[model samples]
Target: MLASTTTTTQISSPPQQKFSLWSPPNPSTFYCSSQLLSKPNKHSQKLQYTERILDQATNILSVLYPTSTKTFSNKPLASLKTFIRDFLKKSKTTFSTLQLALLYLVNLKKSFQNLSFLQENIQLLSDPIFKCGRRMFLASLVIASKVVLEPAPKNIAWSKLSGLPITEINNAERLLLSALNYRVVLPFEEFVEWNILLHSPTVELFQKINLVLKKEIWEGKSNEEDGPHYFVHYQGWKEKWDEWVPESRGLKMTEENLKKQKDLVAAHTTKKPEKKSEATAPSSERGKKRKSEHVDTVDEFAKRVEIKIPIPEELKIKLVDDWETVTKNQRLVSLPRDPTVTQILQKYREHIINNPTSFNEKEGLKSSVFQEEIVEQVTDGLKLYFDKALGNILLYRFERFQYVQLKEKLNNENNGSNNGTEKLGEATHAEKCMSDYYGAEHLLRLFVQLPSLIAHTNMETDAVNVLKDHFALFLQWMVENADELFLKEYEHASAQYLVDAKNCTS
Candidate 1:
């Protein structure tokens, strides 16, 4: 955390506070500015302004980066700009993430001069042709977003946005982390310095022209340290937009300038004239038509799907409970379970055998839902479905890291076994599939999205209805055995695990 201070007080020893990886120092803490404290904080507007500035900066970079490219040829700047803009739009990246990204890029550039600083092999970055330019900056932005955002954008999302494979994105992130020696935290002084260096007044600032200065910050890098940076606030704007402006910017708050700024602000804030309201009868008729059209749209969507699974209220409560434990409480199901999905299906099959009357068995021997052979066939199909969909859609955001790690581990083990290097007592490579590693917790997630998935398939209506019935019955069976099937409690992921996942090193 940054040290706090008063405007007139002498610098004294502040309480020692340990830096937290999850929580960065607030911009407010780095300043002693108290002016315009009464203005209502508009965080949403501030975030929008920050995004606009960053977007403009990238556009500026596009113009400045490559001057030598042939007029008819493709430019790297266009690709870089598109990649950055898409990620920002799709991910809805926060202001803090963007700011930290700039800081990370600067630090990475500094490290490029000293190759000895990096521990891991970063040949991809060290190539003379690559230079610490567009690619490195993009990588730094990805790394910063991962570090600063909770439930960060998944590797798959990053891959799609960057037009790279998931493995490549992961590799880039890992290399960038090593380049910075994992020092992702930005120092308070560095932040202040950068703000002062790149600070510029756009139309947003001029239109919000109520100015206030709080405290003076000495420019530390200079020999004389004579130039001071002050936190400049637009009285009507958010405190977040109140940034450190250096003396070098030569911004004057004289009376005439203030009056001119106010005039501009008035002009910008002026409202457009509204058209006259329509007659009440026409307006009411139009509203009814819109409502009818909305209903028709929903009906059309419903008609496209052949099946609808009705979730029981008790099941809904269970889902809510599960979400509470997994997401809100930061708890996760342990992996490589004793009673895996395959094992659970086997148990359910056995249960049908032990209690024949419990399941919905048809009266005729010609066609029975729970016939031994039919049950076996259904369970086999279910196991295959679970394996296919788990990595793609069944996982929660927090579970994604573990899922990837577990998958790679299983693949390695299977490969080793195939190479005749497996331990005598360990499970064979054939049994190490996802169905044998993940159990009810993961399987339950599949059921939630299964309806929509099944709807999209080209199955006959009869087959879909039959499959839907089987799914419903299976879920009911699982519910009955919830005590043994469901995870009652989950362990919290360790700090190291989270760090590794965030850094894409796991």
Candidate 2:
């Protein structure tokens, strides 16, 4: 096998963007807050206004978007006016002055009934990745309208209104979602918050906020309008909109491309210039050489590779309590594009743990039946069975481990996460998600789930017994509750062989 000399290097560094909304407006700008220090009357106007302002001003705007980052860069009012002009010239989305003013009052309630308990609180956005601006607000409006409106306009329709391409619009939506790492989801509370932000203010004759984009005049698409209009409304008007995406998302010539790639890989992995004389030899005679050449070529890019060692029929390796055959198959794998093999492994693992594929139900239970075994009372025979069982389990589990670790790393390289922000040719293929499969917290929970299957390789003793018991019950539940294709089949196959390690059932 050829040596693995794969290497990669990172050549660029850029400053990161910090999350920010709009800075506060006036010195006496009353920011809302749900003061936790002192108990406040639930029905008071202070509570409503405080929660409303903070909810919007803060990055956790669940009333609008479920996942919003913490940012101080809010200009929704100005953006709102701009948006209304461009899209809702005749639509009912425009709000009247009285209605809008009432909304401001609700959003900015003066402390009444409990003036002594008034507290100044602000939760500035702290995410280091989210940068909210006009584009973000416009995107939010398009998304939130789907939640609030009975019949929302299609995405493409908003493209003309917002002066953005559908792809750009979708990219903006995706960016907002990814940045909103930590968010608050108070359904009922958010309802009240949104109400107050609109027109449910407890105060009367309050001044309406001038919903103007700072440093910008209205560029709304309108032909009929009076001078200095305060309100904009949308009548019941609809237009035909097409939602067709550009060409095919995937290349139609995949088979041809795949074959070419495989051939290239074969050539690279087997580059030893074996004499041409052997090419004329019988196929059986050249099999070993071809296999060796293939391994040699791929080894250049592989971190590790496993090949099963052929065992003679007369010689069997197993434990005294085992009854199986076929043994010793393992190896390693990595990539040449990363700076180090370790970095490649990390990326591979991330792809596998994150990318989920649909498993076929028929394949799930194909290996459920026990492997054929020879019943031999001799001590050596039992020992051979044990070794074989262990080897089979280890080989099967390791193979699965490799696949699950590098699953999505196999995707076409063109589809990357840095969609909207990429410069002319500065494309990137970055990890888009990191989900903790913890489904757990605290020390006790860690002990409960026991992490992935790799952790149970040499497991035994009381802990092993506990895991077996848990496994049996869980397996029973799965065979009862889970869809056939949903459960990971490899895990089950490995577990069955491990259970047969003692050959008790055999």
Candidate 3:
């Protein structure tokens, strides 16, 4: 009886185990399964995420780095996984896991900004980034730490923590600031959204992170009522566009339309005498000269610019066909690319109501009803818009709409907790970006830098004719992989553009 009682008691109360590699880590301890699963935290994710991004950033190292990945081995975080794992185990009280993740993302962005500077520089021949993978990530963390912490440690001290040389850190910092267009302190809401992919969603970590960062960010909520917003700069693009959009737009003068217009003019018009300048020829002769000059200019621009965009053949076949479906009654507007799809749809809806057509639907101009072909044709440089118009259409249509969608998603998600205090800073910023994008001056520069965006995306080829083709492969991937992060950043950029435009105007 005594032996049976002792055995039962012992079985009921199991032995406690501490930090076992094979067994349940703490068998005797009662822990919520949630806490156990969330134990392994951000460092692992940081190492993995940053490693992937580094590979993308350093593929064209010749343009920015002294050497390629083949010539370099990243050693700063040689035991990166082990180090992170050990740190987590040992320093539960000392370190904030959320802070660590945030720092990693900031570092990643820093690395991206560095690459962008080199990619955009007209004179710089070598890519400034020599090493990637573990080295770039660790360096970025150190760099981010300096920016985040009050009275940041010196290079020597950072070297001790990260095991990187003071000199390397110094060199990296210089390249980091060379372009100096990067932001160290991004808005907390954006910061949270940007870092989401760095780890699995853990509400507990998020709550802790907000506290650590000393910001009230949660569930993509920014508690600030009137925080600064970022957007795309229009730089008075609307007013400047008002000047040229109608005048410079290429007329949709198909042979049939041209001939019809010619017949109408012939039926209505009477000949009138006209005067000519001493330098100018007769009206007939002058028209021929001007036509020749315009053709030469178009040819020269095509040859000199050498834009080539890629597309699946299906999109091409659908363009004219799809366009006809949208405009059964009237002619193709040949509107300048300056107009948004929203704008285009709005006008079409108004026309349908005023004219009362039952062509597609009773109430028409639905975005979903219109095929993706419309987006492809407008953005990828098809029949209607010029090469420059592709960029404008891109700015107005695809990019801006992504922002609108993201803002809506966030607003909906936060409906319960929004408390009517959160302002959609994104809307204000996007408006500014659209309004303030530097109009006339940056057009050519935008073109020159565009090819690099293509080249860096593993599409290493020159744009020969259609400028939009260069962006097609990249844009397609972007749409296919459109996640929360992608839209968030796009919204952020649009907002920044607005702020920049305002600043320039001020």
Candidate 4:
């Protein structure tokens, strides 16, 4: 990828013109949409612009990258908004810059390459090159701020403020600029015009003209009750008036949909139940049988949805033992694991390559599963997932210090005297990879949570079953070689490391 460049344009301030609902003057050819210039409703007075804009952005991300939204953290949208708010507060930037950043974010996704690649890979729940969704958006925000803010903070400073690793921020910027083809500049007139349009009085109120992107369960609904719902954002009204309505209701208030909803409700209410024969069994027995059948059906649906990844009894016991050691005894897994995850994955790949038939037989496969390219993709995805998840959920309290220290060490190594050209699009040193410092122990935790991650993906039933089979095979392999692959014991953290951790936390 080429180095990113910014082109700034300056425009002279224009004299203020009298504002009108339909006829607004523009220095640029850009014009507001008719929907934005629609008449305001009475409830428009209660509209809050900033929160509404943020919510819309969040909805877009949720629709685009549902798996990442589910995998990264709980309530990822809330976290994204909080990050933006905190950055603005700490950086003390003007609200105009925030609006500018949001524009860049929306445009960045509009790039065909960016959106296409993400839409394709995000379904697989892994991207080998880029951290998808929220992280990418956050990185774009940083880049946009640099373009708009005078004497903008360096990537390191941004890293400090955002709590992202300098390397990650650097990589994100590089990847994002490549995807965007380095066309991120906005003219002063266009920026101001968009800003005006977004805040226009005639703009559709977030509450009155809401978008219905997908079928989601609303509050007070069970998982099984989830269905397509339209958000009714009243045109030219405040977000407070926004409400969720069933699919029977149109995107906005429509008499047709309202009648449809009413008809459907009445049909359900007036529907007659099928009568059972009383000659075969007593009412109590029949009722018991019906209840059992209902219970079984719900259980089946729950199992399919939850997708419990199979863990062997022995491995479960081992995880339990490991948990006790870490949580009760306050022991830490030793860092820079022997036969690190990368090494183990490489070994597995080699084993499959050499003894293709044996591996296939072990997995009960008749067809050749020896495609090196496919094998590489699977291993790479697992490694990436492990690295992403370790920082989020896999680490125990005691192991967190090691994780931080390892990251700092990798940063130091990459920035060392001998390797200064990494910033110029050089490949990262293999030894400096995050997966190089963690082993099967942490990777195993990711597999246990893999079902939850996979559940959020758009993978088909067959693909999910294939994934489960592959995982079970690999896990069995790990158990067979548990003595060599798994960590046998954990040691207490050194006193100095503990003190450093305390200081860091404080």
Candidate 5:
């Protein structure tokens, strides 16, 4: 659903408060004015710096590496521990930690960049950075807190390393929660898992291709007309460059792999019988049969048959109804039938006759049945009339009449009822009946309207609600039968037009 555009007023915080902490200043305002401003290309430059670090690590790994075999003489368990410890010390970071930090920073930076763009265009302030930064510190600490809890122990603790006061940290954490709208779980791993399950080589290949395309864009080697790059460049060595070769070469490679696999399978499986049986056939029939069999085999080999199941009639109708309901709810149809139009008009006329104080000659002009000459004269004579006086008069009159009718019905029901429960049940049944009657009447009225007689009416709120209900049913019917109806109308119109054109020419 589209977000509602209704504006709501929020009570301002008291003046004694230190800051309107909820309304954080825009990040662009801070980032543009900060020390980071010195490096206009900080994002791309940072990526480059990270890439260099990764390259150095990869180079170290390529060298003589201590493994389980080297660490212990045939002691598999001890050697495995030693291998892991040696690997971590040599790499300068645990693989898991490194992966987590890189993924987190990459995703965070992308999100912040998007937020910055939105802030720039819309001029909306984001959740305060003190909130986000503090949250990040807290989250990192939460993960580390599980392992390290000594008062003054080990490597830099989160609070001390963050350089923020405990109160500020707490406040920042709160801000982060608000900024994120309270969603703390990240779905990076889930996204990868889903991608793997999709099992579409095209999607994976496209991702690799997108990475290279983005790199080309970053290096200023991309064609302007090619279009915007969708992928972000990673701060590491490229992978799958060979697979992204030109389409013709790629297809050739794919075909070659398929042929090799086919050959391998063929080597294992026995061939089918090449000849047909000739038990009861004559010499001439045998020659003809062999030719026919050859043709049949060729036809079968050439055919590319695919099986398709037809959708059931009931399911098709249901799908159409659901689609139409959604579309009608979005107000993508014509003006809905409103039974309240006549009701409201009648009530307004009644009010004008009864309430002399509220009604004047000008208000009487609003009656649709009034003569144009009389309406003009009344409007000319009356002074206190507004443009929307007709609408307001109708609404007030209808509401007044509705209240009176409801009161009368309640009074009658109260006299008949022995208990509240019986009265409530009767009222509910009456309401349901009234709703059904109104819906049916509206539908009947809609179906009877000729195209030439179609008219627009300003419906009251209650009338609009009722009309929407009937409109919903009509939309459901249209969804189920619109295709058949449209085709019939189209053919009829075409034939009629052709006949008319011929008659005119003759």
Candidate 6:
């Protein structure tokens, strides 16, 4: 069923004024509407900033390691922080503190001519990336451990000084290893160590016991005809070092080796599927067939469902009033009747459990039937409410839970659909059907739920598109509108669950 709405007048803002610290002018501040704020703009900005930092670090490394052939650059690296101020300025976004601290660390590293001297002193405090100080040190150690003599020094005491559980440090070590692509040689540390070793032990030993050891090199002099050895001990070390560290042997680059590396990288990298031309009969025909299939499926389902579910008018009006009251006070609205909602939701769960679909028997039986049922019931009920225009306002508050759950289910199925041809196609079709059906259903649900009428709105298309375009926005709205006190408790419990998972995994 198509969920359509009538629009109303747009909410106008006051005239612009000079910017001030107290009233900072930004889109995030001016458009406090949850609908407007739900767009991926903020998230895109955050990703962009992360890419920029990585790019900057890559450039710094390239400068330091000019001889290295490896390159580290991504296309979207520079566009990472355009609208970041909007989100970072808000105190509610806890990641801002973590982002700032990370930036500070990066800046400190860039300032140093050589990071080796400052390596031991570096420590991160409850940073989001590391999560704790021990994690931070462990991540650094994963890079620098080879250079330092007492890598995990007892005197440093990670547990006591960092105040982190030993388990978290271990987990962080694994994460860092994965992030660095398991390249144990960490070129930066290797280079730093090579420099130190060359100056102290290698050079001094060669000079002291020289048998025909180029005395002119120590006298701060050089001859043009002295050949390659006069420049540096490149050949001598290249020969000796290979024997000393067999793992580092045969490291010379050649045309064949270069081609092999390129081929391997190309094979591993994901290639975008070729898009079919609009004129192609197969692509056009498939689109038409899909549309007809959806229409037929929906029509048949509607016809079978002869009973019209009765919605409580009093409940609808109460929800509308509650939504308005909460929005006015800049607070999230609680579920009107939590026990009643929960009970109705539970009933729907039973319906799904008792009624078996072929796919459900194989897939649903493997998962938490209770959780699956809860999600299905919640989604179906919300769709019903939206189709009837019973209570658009309150319904928006719970919309996100449905979107997240559906997306997660689709992702899980996609990952596990490789068993057989019949199962594979069925899984793929099921994922697509669920995604598109729920997406459209949820969009229509939001259209009916908005406080303002959609009919006469100035930005009618924009408003409609807002509901249709982004599911993430709906999730954000649900979190914002849901009861804050309950949400805080839920989040705390959730965080604890994550911490417990980390502990178990460790």
Candidate 6, 1-506: lDDT as tens digits: 11112211121232332110011100111111233223345334333333333233222222221222121121122211221222222211222122222322232333333355235334431234433222333344323332222222321243334444445444554444443334433222222222222222222323322323344223442445432221122221331222111212322222244467669879977676767766677876898996664444323212211111222343334334544443343233222223233233344455445554633454443233324533453344333333223211223332333333444665566655644343211334433323133222123234333322221112224323332222232233333334421222111124443344323310
Q: Roughly what TM-score does model 4 have, to 2 decimal places?
A: 0.43
**Tens digits of lDDT, candidate 1, 1-506:** 11121111111222332211112212211110111112224343233333444444453233222223332113343444344544565556544565667666545545545547444456655643234245555566677666555456666676666565565556656666766667775553344333322323432222221121111122245444544543344533543464555566543432345567779989998977655776566867997996664344333222323456765566666776766676567677887776899899999878765666745444232235556765675676566556655654455555667877887787677767677565222336364778888888777765665553444233445555556666777787877787888776788889887776455421
- Which clashing pairs does model 6 show? 6-454, 6-455, 7-453, 7-454, 7-455, 7-456, 8-457, 48-80, 49-80, 392-449
For residues 1-506, write the lDDT of model 4, one tens digit per residue.
32323322222232332111111111111112111112233122112333444455544443333324443323334454445445555665434455666566555444433456566545332433233566766566666666655566667676667666667677667666656556666643345344434442222322222232122324436355555444444434554566666655433222344467668879867946656767636866888996664444323222322345788888877877776777668677776789899899988878766777876766676343356665565676676556545554566655666777777776677768346555211226433666887887777776665654444232346545555655776788788889999887787877897776544420
- Each model's TM-score, in the order given? 0.40, 0.20, 0.26, 0.43, 0.20, 0.19
Lowest summed lDDT window (length 10), candidate 3: 19-28
lDDT of 5 at 137: 31
Tens digits of per-residue lDDT for model 3 on 382-428?
A: 21111222222222211333334444555664443455455433333
Give the TM-score (vs. native) of candidate 6.
0.19
Instruction: Please write out the lDDT profile of model 5 over residues 211-307, one tens digit for every residue.
Output: 4334422333356554432222222224222122332233211324557756877986766655565753575588899666434433322222211
Ranking by TM-score: 4, 1, 3, 5, 2, 6
Q: Supply candidate 4's per-residue lDDT for 95.
A: 44
Better of 1 and 6 by TM-score: 1
Identify the runs in model 5 with alpha carbons over 4 angstroms from their true place. Answer: 1-156, 161-177, 186-506
Which should have the higher lDDT, number 1 or number 2?
Answer: 1
lDDT score for residue 378 of model 2: 16
Candidate 2: tens digits of C-alpha lDDT, residues 169-247 = 6555444333332121113222222333332121111112223221111234423442222121121122122121221
* Segments in model 1 whose C-alpha atoms lie over 4 Å from true places: 1-305, 361-366, 419-431
Query: What lDDT does candidate 1 reach at residue 129?
Result: 20
Candidate ranking under lDDT, highest first, comes to 4, 1, 3, 6, 5, 2
Looking at model 4, residue 37 earns an lDDT score of 17
**lDDT measured at residue 39 in model 6 versus the true structure, 0 to 100:** 32
All candidates: CA RMSD (Å): 21.6, 30.2, 26.3, 23.6, 28.8, 29.6
